[model samples]
Target: MPAVDWRVTRLSRRRSTVTRAQVETVTGRALGLFGLVFGAQTVPIALVQADALLPGAGAALMAVLYGAIVGLAVATVTKVAVRTACLAFALLYALALVAWPFLVDDPAALHGAAPWLYYLCTVATTAAVVAVLPVWAAAYTIVVPAVYGVIRLLPSGGDAGPLLAVLDALYAVVLGVVVLVIVTMLRQTAGAVDAAQEAALERYDVAARLHANEIERVKVDALVHDSVLTTLLSAAAASTPEQQQLAARMARDAVQRLDEAGATGPRALDRVGLPVLVRRLRAALTTFTTPFTVRVVNAGGVELPVEAVEALYAAAVQAMVNSLQHADEPGLSTRRELRIRGVRAGGCVIEIADNGRGFAMDRVPAERLGLRVSIEERMANAGGMAHIESRIGHGTTVTVAWPQGAGGAA
Candidate 1:
């Protein structure tokens, strides 16, 4: 035999709960119908049997009123409301059933000589009790019939022996026990089904999150291979003195990349002022071969988390490096600009623009990770975003922004 799939079992249990609830609702309505039919039959019988209609008339009216209320509540109310109404009705009906014999003008009328209508009322009320409160209904079922047996044994009972009374009581008790067991089992089954559904939903959520993290890790690995490793290989193959100097700068860039990777731990990236970060980037740019200008506006006091700062810094540096390597003119002067500004709505914006030859963004090679990984993905991982605009003729512009109150990715 195949091993049981717990997930499938849990899903099946969940579905079964709805079916059980529907069945219980139908059963409650059926009991209501029984009450309505019993009341309709007994009311006229009660009126005809009693000669005077004052206290006796009140009992007949009460039977109709109780039955109507129970029927209406069960038919129209929600599941919870139906249960509440049934419980209330069961308690009141039990009390009335126990007192019914004593309320009559003739105590002998309740003995073996009692009308069929009287016995019918007892059976209907007992059934309603059994339908709603299973445990309490069992006690009521036993108590009600035992009370009738004792009443029949009295001197006023007339012609009723102990054997006949015992038989009548036993019938009611047996029927009640059967109804009680069924209702109890249904309730327990519904509860177990509900619990299984909740467990299944929790497991599904955990699985979905694990799948997403795996996809993200794959993307990060591809990014590292394309950018850092490619730069190291190119730097090792340089021939000219100027090429060697450029390769030394690339080696320093590679070391910075390694430092950023090692600083991925939360403790290493402490919150720092935006102005301090801008000043540091300005100092780093002085070593570059290309002429560059750094500009800061209204960004002196803005604070960002360490991880966000590292991500923004790395993305800005990559954009500058790309401009130096790719954007060049034979005779015309070319310069790159780095602009940092604090947004009034919160967070900060960093823009890197070049007045040099720009390439088509869509035509960039898939293996090239300068814009994809080092700039865009890095910013996204920091809970920020990078936007790049470029045309073959017009210069390239890269804008990186971190939104207000963003916590960098873990």
Candidate 2:
């Protein structure tokens, strides 16, 4: 599988988060609608009162001035459209309703402004503020209409005045209930949406982790199968002459021993000594190649952890392959050599060196997948280090080192 670039992955996740936020912002439809309704209602009141309502200015001057204010309010707060005559007419209608009662100065002119209709409209306006506006805005809207209605109805007090007050209270209660229901439902829906989004993100994270884990397991299995199994199979099928041959016979026996150990090799890390494991590695290397010396200089007197053992083994195998592949053999190239050294200070170090021509470190890119997966990553996971040193004519050395555990006292 191809590796994912972390920077690109992070950027994609960030873009998705931003898109979700924009969707949430647009969900406030009620607020935008209320702004349009209130702003449109301001227009016609300014229009008809333009002529007779000027205090000092002449009718023409007053008309133009009021028209400007209405136009400004409509343009800013409502959706403007040059083609929609119906919307313009609706604005004109609202203006006439608001201005007619004041301009005619007659109780009869208030007939179109039915008390029940006025109650519903004012309550709706108040509820709109409660639903979509800020606390102070809702208060201002409710207070203004309430005060005007009370002053108009109470001063003309009669037996019916109390009935009107009762009706107003009933309307207030109904509006309160409606607003409560609407707000509650909207809040619940918003909460559910947020929860669903959070769940999706969590699932994505889990899926990504699972896929990464499976890929790593596949890689480890492949490495062991290809290197360890191939060598052993050759040894098992060797002929009588090849059996006596050091290189051919050693290759065959290394595989057999490794297979036998494979049954208990893992347990060796937990219970066996580092000295035995290093000796086995040396024997395996000797089995496969002649004129290549395999020696353990120091074992550190410690048994490494399972992770560290696996890392050391893998690094040694890789080093043997490199020696076989690139050793400088002008004629027979029989002078090729390999060594394994173990040390104990704060930690155990497993070093593999070969007599082979090496390339410059910079010749290998950081993204070289084989080296990263095989050597670097394995040691790192075990809290260890894999260090490589080499020059053009000189051989290469690969060292895998990790701190000793409490039980493994080298």
Candidate 3:
């Protein structure tokens, strides 16, 4: 059968279905757009308040402010350096507010309904929601507005009434807090969804494996009854030379059939070049369901167990299946790597590793033959050793080495 060519193959990026990741991404973009709204109002406000500023110092500030706004706008779509852009915009806004008294040419000339910086507090506070922790977000919402409220009482701030100044400060804090609460709550809910989905997937994997085992068991039982038992009964009933000869031929044919059904025997095959094994292994990797970042290093010079390459390939496939089923860690992006290398002295090593939630060897149930018979035993039976190493939070690495403990990795 031909391997299915999935739309999302090895070359395609891993598209995460995890809700928490999606929520964070969409929220970041939303904040960017919100920043643009406040950013648009900045130009007119700056123009109206220009006469109140010191021409030289204020012109430089205006240039920096414009650059920061442009950065904030770009961060909306690209999502690259989003945190950096948000911090840059917020810091610039605070700096401008702090220097407002010195920047002004005269106190009365600064008269306006609201200071130029007031329009941008929404942008800064919203930006804080995405890039900062809850405590820092709270500080940004309160401290930035409080600074403006203090300035609102001074002549340089246009000397607004006490009631209006307090209200404006209160308004900024309320808006910031509301945004913070919404995002935080949504993130928590999404995280719970992700955990539940992973648990369901794990259960599905277990059920699928059990169903496959039952199918294999039925096949083996049929093979024994239809082939081996029939050959034995014929041999026992034989009395004449012709009948005996016929039984001998039937027995030989039945043994060949049993061999095809995976009966192990000491069979020697001519050693082939390492490149041959690599070509075979690489082709096998392409047929796997999960995409792995494959790296072929020093896959030349050495040759391994010739026909036994199939054993290595089978082990590799099993490892890939294990990674696909359970390597996704909550709140962390997953990455898988397949490394194939030819070492000194007719030896090779194949490693399948994942940066995901790992497991302790002692903790895994004994009945899970995936690690025992499929990977470890298969490799060992083929004159290779399979080493599995993992930590709870770190990750997992399965290494298949030929000529067990015999040669240095290339």
Best by TM-score: 3
Ranking by TM-score: 3, 1, 2
Residue 138 of model 2, lDDT score: 46
The true-versus-predicted C-alpha distance at residue 146 of model 1, in Å, is 1.8
Q: What is the model-wide C-alpha lDDT for candidate 2?
A: 0.47
- lDDT scores for all predictions? 0.62, 0.47, 0.74
What are the per-residue Cα lDDT tens digits for candidate 1 across 1-410? 22224543453344223334444666676666666676667666556545422365556646655564555455433333455466556555556545555555554444445433334534444455534556566677677667666655653333368887677667766776666666667766754664454354445435534554565556456546865676677677878888888878777776776666555522221244565457557756988976677666666447665566677888998999998888887786776899887765247788899877888888999899999999988888787889888877678898888862322311
lDDT of 2 by residue, 46-97 (tens): 3433333324322443344334335433532342321122223223333433
Clashes (backbone N, CA, C under 3 Å), per candidate, total 0, 6, 0
lDDT per residue, candidate 3, 346-366, as tens digits? 778888999889999999899
**Per-model TM-score versus the true fold:** 0.45, 0.32, 0.57
Q: Candidate 1: list runs displaced more than 4 Å.
A: 1-24, 50-56, 59-72, 75-77, 107-134, 152-159, 219-410
Among these predicted structures, which one has the highest lDDT? 3
Cα error, candidate 2, residue 194 (Å) = 1.3
As a TM-score, model 2 comes out at 0.32
